[model samples]
Target: MRYSILTLATQALQKQQRWPQIIAPEKLKPHYDIIIVGAGGHGLATAYYLSHNHDINDVLVIDSSWIGGGNTARNTTIVRSDYLLPASFALKNFALQLWDSLSQALNFNLMYSPRGYLDLAHSDGELEHFMLRANAMCLGGASASILTNSQIAEKIPALNLDQQSRFPIRGALFQAEGGVVRHDAVAWGFARKSSEKGVHIQQNCAVNKLLTSNGRISGVSTHRGKISANSVLVAAAGGSERLMANAGVPLPMEPINVQAFVTEPIKPVLDHVVNYNAGLSYLSQSDKGELVMGGATDGYLSTARRGSFARLEDTMMRAAQIFPFISNLRLMRHWSGTADIPMDGNAIVGRTEIENLFVNCGWGYAGFKATPAVGWKLAELIADGKLPEMLKPFALSRFTDGALIDDAGIGPYPWLH
Candidate 1:
């Protein structure tokens, strides 16, 4: 059902029980034109774009678990495009543009809030580095500006601005277009629209191995049965490495655990997403008034979905340093997601060594923000048999050709990325 003001009134009058399911479970198909392994945000969004944008509806999205129950459900929900590199800036900026109208296009309320983003710097040198990034963002046609310490103080009065404090606020990089969205809503919206457009979504069906008939394309062997497809895309995030390895193509990516959590509800105290660059932590406030926050990855290699309280304590300490009020709030919930960190910090998003196989992992913590753009471009790549220009920089062959787009200058260290 299409949601609107009238639909709300009508449903209210009928006791609100007539609303239909967002997406219906589908039986395994014998074959499909395209098969996407992983029904997370990128997978579902790709299915929707394939049917909606490219008129290719014969697509199957299979997941071992329920849709959006993977990394899609385990994120801090922050979105932004203030990247320093040109290639990274273009892709993310395109995603940000799509985000402005996605809720309406999908006929679902994403609860997107353009509440701005503040990257706090602790020293003059750090502020200068942010200025370079801001310049790059503006060059790519994205909005960004520098904020002095006084400006940040006026903007976020709840922040701890004591000059004597360690890592005191010196300045920040502010972007008006960066903010948060309802993460689950993004997955559900795409799944609903994709299902409505005749795309098959099979949940609880794991793709165990990649079945290639020759040096070219073939199909996948799922838990249910063998399903043939003309092409396959492994956008499975953490699972991409294993699935691609089944095709004899080892991915230059490693899965690492990243954690995030929220605090007890309170009256609104934060209006913008704040990143403590010095402390390597970020935070924002949800609609329900919960302070959503996170820090760096686990700094090790692991695929486990659970997080250690030790890391959570470290993140909480960082948050308390900047937003002292958080020290008084009780922890409501905490969880971790497996991040597929590529050799280079940039995402890998193009064809693999296998003829008909493509990859779209290595997004790390930035996957949630790049969902729409990746979907739109990956669908174009499959339907048109040519990679979109925006995604060429993320090709898997870049590593072999020494064309690595290392946006973070973090080298090929997956754990550091």
Candidate 2:
């Protein structure tokens, strides 16, 4: 039997089927200074920042399964800040800064490769949009270099240089800070270090409900028991909606399944992290020398994270277009993970209706790149009673406050998924 290797998630109905453990009522903690209800990258990262930055160590990082096993481990693992918004740039900047220093911070070799990221353009308007975004990046103090087709060819000679195709590579806006990380290592490192610092890293603990008191956040009821808290931060990506509904504040979220596959270990043919500039497709290479490739969800809604036959067909067509040698690669493994899509293709990182309740979700497919920043500001929000400058704009009230943070300007479809 061909066994699937996707694991590392504790609570991501986004991809794997993780069963929440059944707690027997007595094993719960009666109270904690803070309780973060998600053990994914965002949740665990939040816990790390809370303990390390905010000195809130009497905390717990509980997952339905295990830390970083969710979206954190299942990504194509490209980190970039080529977004078209100010807020995104700021958050990404912080995350990039953290990634640059993550090896030391987590005390583990994360295998972070600054191999560069490229957004290929196919037409004049597409090229124009790239420049506009590049200009936006310049204003944000981020180095976004615009490379011509010739420079692109020189930087990546493996691409099919033919000028005619459905989506041809015209030019690219390369971000030097952008790269790939070993997703599982980053997660395990954070979990390892944070546990050493005395934060209870509980696996197999799934939160079943959010206990409320007098119209404020109180605690979480888990399968292992209950942990009361002065504040709660919900960073569950795929499980965000279901958990929020327990608190009576349902943020608009659609669980979309994104599929990714790694080819049988091939000699490195693709160099940089290849980005689908026209849309949401992106490809990269693993340290083991596998040609890892993936793209957007099929613009449909489902909690299921199974790979569809259609996605394999769609991505293979695009891959062959970029590098004809990709045709010789064999499919080694295939799996799909969950992504949360809000009405707008952006993240929600602020207050919910419940006073002590907060959110760091709806990241769509782009949250992994902003992990460190999200963890920092979310820890601040959980520590201080106010929103920080970086996370202030992405508040949940945006939808009702007549404000929206639609970065890429992709409408409700979340094509960036």
Candidate 3:
């Protein structure tokens, strides 16, 4: 049933007790045309695109946990297209465009807000670097501007800009089109739409092994049973490395733990998503009035979905320096999620060495922003068997061809990226 005012009225008349299920569970079939591993936002979006755009509904998306229960739920939910590289800028700009219409297209309230994004610069060198990135973003069809210290102060008056303080604010790289969205809503929206279009979503079904026949993928062996498929695409994010390794494909990605915390609900004080470039901390105010904040990775490789308290303390200290008003805010909750960081700092997407196998992983800290674009491009690649222009630079073969897309110029370090 379409979600509209009439349906809502009817439901209201019925005492709001007999609503239809958002997505119905289905029994495992003998075979499928395509089997995608991982049921996060990216996987669900990929399935939706495949069924809706390509008219291919014989697809199945499996996950070990429930939908939106992974990194998709742990993220700070900031979305932006501002990047220093042309390739990344194009891909992310496309994603931002998709986010604009995603709510209406999926017939769901994603709560997307284009409140803007500000990347604070604490030093003159950082300001110059941001200027270069801003120019690149503008050239790639994303709105970006360099904000002076005075303008920054005017825009975000609550921010502490005292010159005597440590790491005083200098300026910021402002992207007027960047903002935040309800992260879980994105996943649920796609899952509902895909399921309604005849795509199967199976949770708690962990894939144990890749089933191959004579050099090509035949299917996957899950904890439930062996499911056969003509093609397999792994969009497992942090779990991508292990899944691919099981299929005898070694990926140059590491699973690292990244942490985030949220403060108690308070009056709205922040208007835009803020990032401290020098301190490596980013934060935004949620619709519920909670201050969501996060910082850099723990600088180690682990599949554990938790971080050390030391890292949390460091993040809080830096966050306090930027937003002094939150110095004494009571922390409500904190959590961590694993992200797959590639050596070159860019995502690894497209067909792999295995003939019938493909991968869409290694997004690191940028996955949430790139979900839509990645889904559209990966669906196009799988449906038509050709890499889209926007995704060609992210192909896994780039590592061997000596073509690395390190936007930060931090060479060959997964954690640093």
Candidate 4:
């Protein structure tokens, strides 16, 4: 059912008991043209675009848990495309363009707000780097500007800009089109639209093993039953490594825990998403008035979705150095999510050695922003059997060829990415 004022009023008059389910809990089909693993934003979006754009409706999306129950629901929603690399900027900028009109396309309210994003620089060297990045972003058709220290102070009066601080404010790279979106709404909107278009979404269905016939994918053995598919796409986020490994494909990525916390709702103060270069922390004020914040990944790698107090303390200390008022607020809650960080700090997308099986993973911390582009590209690859030029840079062969697309330019260190 389309959500609108008339539907809401009708439901209210009926005592709100007669409302349609967002997505039908359909039974597992015996066969499909394509099967996508993980019902998060990426997989659901892929299914949606496959049916809506490519006219391929015989698709099935299977997940172990409820939709959006994994990293999709645990992200601090920030979207931008101010990257130093050409391919990264293009993909993220494309996703941002999709986010701009996603609500209208899906006929669902996604709550996407394009309220600017600012990355702070603590020194002259950092400012110089940002100036170069801003130029590159503008050349690539993305809006970016350099803001001086005085301009930053004028924009954010509550920020601590004293020289006495450990990391004094210098300047920043600002993107007027960067912003955030409602994370859960993105998943639900895609799922609802895809289900309406004759796609099957099966929840609580775990893939036990991958079935291959003559070195090509034939089907998948799930908890529910065996399902056949001509093509299989693995868009699982943290579970990508294991899912691929089960299919005899080893990935050079590791799962790491990332944590985020929020403060009690207060009057609106922060007007834009803020990132501190030296502190390794980023924050933005949610529409509900809570101060949503997060920090760097843990030093070690693990799939456990819980962080140590030491990391939390370090993040709080750095946040206080930038926003002094944080000390007065009470912590509401904190949570963690698992991310698959590639060795070169870049995403891995495209075909694997196994023909008929495609993988889209290694997104690390940027998967939320790249959802739409990843889906669009993966759908194109599956439907046409040809990789797009934009995604060729991220193919698995890049690692073997030593043509890594390291966005940070920090070499092949996974943690730094």
Best by lDDT: 3
Give model 3's clash tally: 0
Per-model C-alpha lDDT, please? 0.89, 0.80, 0.90, 0.89
Local accuracy of candidate 2 as per-residue lDDT tens digits, 1-417: 111233334335455455322211222357777778787788878888888998888777777886667888888888988888788788997788789989877866788898999988888888898899999988888889889988988878888868877777778889988999888777777776666666776777888988888999889888766788888888888787888986899887788878888889877766798876555557888878888888778668867777677877888878888888888878898888778988887888988888888888998777888887898888888887778999888988888876778765665556443
Off by over 4 Å in 4: none
Question: What's every prediction's RMSD, in angstroms?
Answer: 1.2, 7.4, 1.1, 1.2
* Cα lDDT tens digits for candidate 4, 254-331: 888888999999998998989988958899999899999989888568778888787788888888889999999988
Compute the lDDT of residue 150 as modeled in candidate 2.
89
The order by descending lDDT is: 3, 4, 1, 2
Span of 10 residues, lowest total lDDT, candidate 2: 19-28
| Per-residue accuracy of model 1 over 225-291 as CA lDDT, tens digit each | 8999999999888888888887898888887889998899999888999998775789998889999
Off by over 4 Å in 1: none
Estimate the TM-score of every prediction.
0.97, 0.90, 0.98, 0.98
lDDT (0-100) at residue 171 of candidate 4? 87
Candidate 1 residue-wise lDDT at 216: 68
- Prediction 1 TM-score vs. true: 0.97
